[model samples]
Target: MGIYGALSTAVTGLRAQSFALENVSGNIANSQTIGFKRIDTDFVDLIPDAAPKRQTSGSVLAQAHSTNNVQGDVKGAATETYMAINGNGFFVVEPRAGQADGSATFSGANFYTRRGDFELDKSGYLVNGAGYYLKGLPIDAATQNISGSVPQVLQVSNAFLPAQQTTRVNYELNLPQLPKTPKYQASQSSGSELLSATDFMTLTPDQAATTTGAATTAGAATSSLASAGETLTIQIGATSRTYTFNSGGSTTMPAIDISDTSTDTIGEVLAAIQADLVTAGATGATVGLDGTGKIAITAGNATDTITVTDGTSGTSATGFNLANGTTDPTVATSTALAARVATVTADQTDDFLNQSVSGGAITVYSSNGAPAQIQMRWAKVNSTENGGAERWNLFVLTNGNATGSGTAWTRMGGDYTFGADGSPSPAIDHTDLPNLTVNGVLVGDIRLQHGAHGLTQFADPNGTAEVTTIKQNGYPAGEFVSVAVNDSGRVVVSYNNGQQLEVAQVVTANFNAVNQLKRMDGGLFAATSESGEPILDNGGGVIGSSLEASNTDISEEFTKLIVTQQAYAAGTKIVSTADEMLQQALNMLR
Candidate 1:
């Protein structure tokens, strides 16, 4: 190659250096742009075909090199809808084609972008700062699940959310073993801490079962006293009365004598005993013998208990087959027929309130968006310490202010019994409240779900129920308030009714050869043969309330700028020298 050839090569060098300088200038200009990827220039040399030793570099060419795969610095942003990718990904987007019928139209073609400064437009479309619309999978509000895998341009509106009826309530709580209720005192008996079953009974009177002694000879009341001066004692509550049998004395003599074995028959002896009980202020007490001549005794009131004892001197009480101790005629057990009334009558409302402890309350919505607050209470019907299995009953107040003859509360039917391990005996995971009506609003049947081992009967020193989790799957109708993106790439929308729902799923698109994508305006990219098809839902995590800064480094671009300037000047110097040599050759020829 001669001087002319050198001039042509110099020209190519200048072109390449100019291209490099242009790239550096562009990088420096967009150094602060959001989600900007800087471009670099690559030089390729052209060689002439010749023998191995004779081959020479002929020309130079400049080509644009992409830095699309490089990551930008992510920083927090003020906008809630703005997002940034932590690694490798692009947000699926599309440009608006045109407006028709006063509505924004979208081009069916999909474009990928890193600019996530998105906001809700007037038409309810999520558009970015560059006017590109975001694409995502619509989610079912009721089921809270993504509709499909295919993404479309999302348009979220501020429409009112319809009310949902309450179907189920998730509940998990711990019940105290020994509830220290208001009616319980340390000086009281061990079972006093539990609810009084008699106070809420409506079917039958809470009467103790009659206690019968061993059978004796029929109508043969003759000298079984083992001698005179034999005494028998019957005590009710704090009052005690004694009966002494005297020879030849009337069955009602001595004001405390019940019978004489020589003269009084068994019926007369029992009658005298009943009279003595009336005189001793045991008003409702009864003393009698069954048809088989067995001595039977009954207590007066529900609260009063009876204790019978034999005298030390004589076998008079023993002759009647009565032992020394408290009689079996005691208050009815909680499981008795009367204490199992399912509904709390108005007359028993006060007693019900005093027996049961608060079990928390929650407001639920009806199908028509009507709101009703449900109040719950837990009653300990039986305890292990009281010679019964640990059992409980849950009740809901129907009418707090109900008076005589009206229903006040209704029991959610179940004998919630617990085993020794503090877990439900049969594992009660759920129950239902049938047509629960509070105050006057009727709430349909709702399933009360208690997860595995959700209800516990532990020893709580405070003697209060601890509700760990209580939430219902229903809400009143609400107006939309705002929207936000989460780190999990879900679009969450908030409402005025204190409801937050996942309305859409924002998926990321990735490519095999991301650097080979065709760059477009507004930080967007189009797929190319070399870039491969868009692979979705497999990209890096999305960071919400943040933005990705430009990948261009100002200092590096400035350095390249200086180097390109020097190279361009050197190329110009080579052209000047080549022209001077041509002039020298012409002068020599002259």
Candidate 2:
């Protein structure tokens, strides 16, 4: 290993430098390529085993080192279908084997790539710029879930989507406590605000639901001269307010002042008590002595149950025959309408509009893809301020074009009541609208799902129903218009009918030894024994509407280019020196 050995080593050095130059050139050329992983040359020494004293410097060999694991800068793209991998992973793809009947056919072999310049091809297949088709799991539109684990070449079908009938409607709305309708006048005290119970004749008035107290017999007797302060408590539903008997009627709730229990007649005291009850949010309450001189109290709204408690002074309520520890027996239920008219007739349309305020409206689809717009209105029947349970009735316009005796608006069901806290008393989570037909189109019976606490009756400044959310699970027939990939790696296909349906889920594959993968054309890779099998679900993430820049750095590649050139020249100089030495040896021999 003398002159020849030196010459052979110099030649190997030149070869390794050339390989490095080639890698640098390739890296610089594809510096702007999308998702391109640059290749770098690695030098390996080929050393021969020898004794310690006779050891020689080793020859060099160049091997390709991949930068597959290195990440590139991600940039936004105009195309929605274009995507990028944010971290360690490769998009599962397949190459088109050939064309059959003017359609692309794929070979079943799997290839992986970071290149994501994907766009919907003419055949509805998502293909990248390099002609590799993307593979993913198909999603069921009905269930909105991925169907299978195995991924295949995804092809969005342009076929017309069949119509879906509306099965359920999700409704969330807040009804105004005081619905100011057209008939309402702020100046008027009574009958200005529409009352649905009396206006629509929906519920029958209870004839015998009165609770009577014992007689206040010959009450000219002077019961103490109002020295000890006493209070009377009246509770309606869950709300309670206390009334204090004061010498002067001046308190937060306008306290009742029977100046002198002896001078003030029993009727005057009872009248003042009735005024206090009305001030405390009792609607249409009748409190007076009957023909037998017994005190009587009746709630106007048949649904409301009332309870009256006497004060601890034992003089205030006990004088009116209301026992100290007894609750007056009252009716707890409102009787259903004896002659209930389920819907408002065409002639009653004007009356209904003046009585009820607009709830909201939504366009729903029928079984045959027919579209119909249904308008809703709410009529508050009874109010706590009016001595009744806060109640309302819902109605939907069924036929706007109906004439003569046709039904204009149909009531949904019985009255919906609210508690003192504005939440529905019965918790109307869902209700069935039997045979719901809108504008002559049969929409079938659909369930109006309110969920938990969906409907609320709260005081609104605008005095109008505020609808928050209204949506239905129905769509008319749609034609595929475009396709895009979402952030979650799901392929969404848009239709001409303004509906976007999820069709497929994009899948990525990971490798244990990513750099050991076999590189192919178009930035693709094939699995090798060293790279191991593809891991399907461990990808970092799929970024939609973006493209990953090439990992190659142009400035770095230029610097390497200069170094390779200098090394090649040095190797040539070493070869030239070896040649000159050989020439000298020949001359000496001569």
Candidate 3:
């Protein structure tokens, strides 16, 4: 029984050494494989019985163990989708069931792999060389955030992106402290110039008789019945009917009557007459008394003009004249916008070369994703004339379909003022450009936002009006340009409109006992009970555009190969010696 047992034990030793040699051979074979983990033979001693000092060594068993925790040398690759694990995680993947319509179909059953030489398939799915599809979390286009917790087979679409309307425009700039082109010399604020309003020339006349005359100063000049015989006439707009008036008589609207008594001040008479003309629709203008006791009428826009005829009699002859208010289309054309604004000095006489003016052009998208170019012109409103304080009036515009002076450049809104430091004081709000309807299309209201005094008034040599940061929350319709996998495991897709969108985030699966994973074909592994359940790892262990080299070293594998060969030879010698001894025993029995 002892002799037979010795022979069986020697046979087991031969088998164990051969198993170790097989492991060494396999390691050397897959030395060039991507993400290949080397296998090592673990020898276990099997003993039959132990009798204190005399124990029989039975045989040896060889078990294949994996060095899954070992890291491999990373190599750069030309493919953008090539990835390598840097830390302790595996790329979550799934095997494809079959190919249909040139697209690789997923099998739903999840698997894991260290191999990441993936490429986009026909259906836009990222598939590895081993036919396993990469799994990742989907990213919402609007939010650009991961949608769900569980990962799914990632696929990208090559569809065109829809046009989006512009809501906000962000601007950050540094303006010079000096005027680029001084447009104002007035001491008052350069308010927005309007089009439909006009303040008639200041009035000057006799005290008693001139009481009927328009005075730029505040005064009480009543109507005089002594000159009630005079007749007054007025008209409005480019083509309006003239209205006649009489003093101390009853009148209904456009044919207004003046007071015969000295009770009515010059302002009261103008107010009454102006009200009657507006009600009659002869002029769509509002009339008011200026501080100089003069009459100021406004129609809110530059489309119309008011024409008045001060009768050469009582109030009409003395206080009122054609200069007070007129329907002459050419009279108030120059001062139309300036007269309405409170402190605007649009009529300043300053040299254009002395002032610094900066201009910038930016493309803003409409609600329908239509492209519209916005021309921003900044002209210095205050210069050395107002001490050293620097101020600017920014004019936003777009080329309109019109060819006339007032209609050529479609002004977006009123002039915006910048502070001495070149920053907006109140900050730009929603500026409506009603006339900016290019050929009838409605471009939405645009507002400028500056973050943390983004606009500065620093002096520069080149007059460089740098748009440090200018961005809009809108884009026109665009076609897919290209796709790339980022280091953060995000799949970024670019569009022809210069916009990039993150479509998906690749997820990784890691195990507590990675060494317990069961090896499979093509550098893949299956989770076992010995290997802990797969956990979601967001540690960003995967690097894109690179590949991981096999952990198996040729020198180490050759060394193991040499030792394994010698061990196998010794095992064979043991078997041969055991056979010889058994033969001797058998001969002795014979």
Q: Count the backbone clashes (under 3 Å) in each candidate.
A: 0, 3, 23
TM-score of each: 0.80, 0.77, 0.70
lDDT of 1 by residue, 200-317 (tens): 6533222222234446553646345324676677776555887676665555543333244534566666667777777778777777765656666666665555666666233444
**Predicted candidate 3 versus true structure: per-residue lDDT over 93-168, tens digit per residue:** 8888887887677667778888989998878888888888899899998899888888899998999988887766
Candidate No. with top lDDT: 1
lDDT accuracy of residue 376 in candidate 1: 85
lDDT of 2 at 448: 82
Which one wins by TM-score: 1 or 2?
1
- Best TM-score goes to which candidate? 1
lDDT of the structure predicted as candidate 3: 0.64
Candidate 2: give the clashing pairs.
Answer: 282-387, 283-386, 283-387
Q: What lDDT is obtained when candidate 1 is compared to the true structure?
A: 0.79
Name the regions of candidate 3 deviating beyond 4 angstroms. Answer: 1-3, 98-107, 182-356, 367-369, 383-391, 400-402, 410-423, 427-442, 459-464
Off by over 4 Å in 1: 202-335, 344-351, 403-405
Q: What's the candidate order when arranged by decreasing TM-score?
A: 1, 2, 3
RMSD of candidates 1 onward, in order: 7.0, 10.0, 11.3
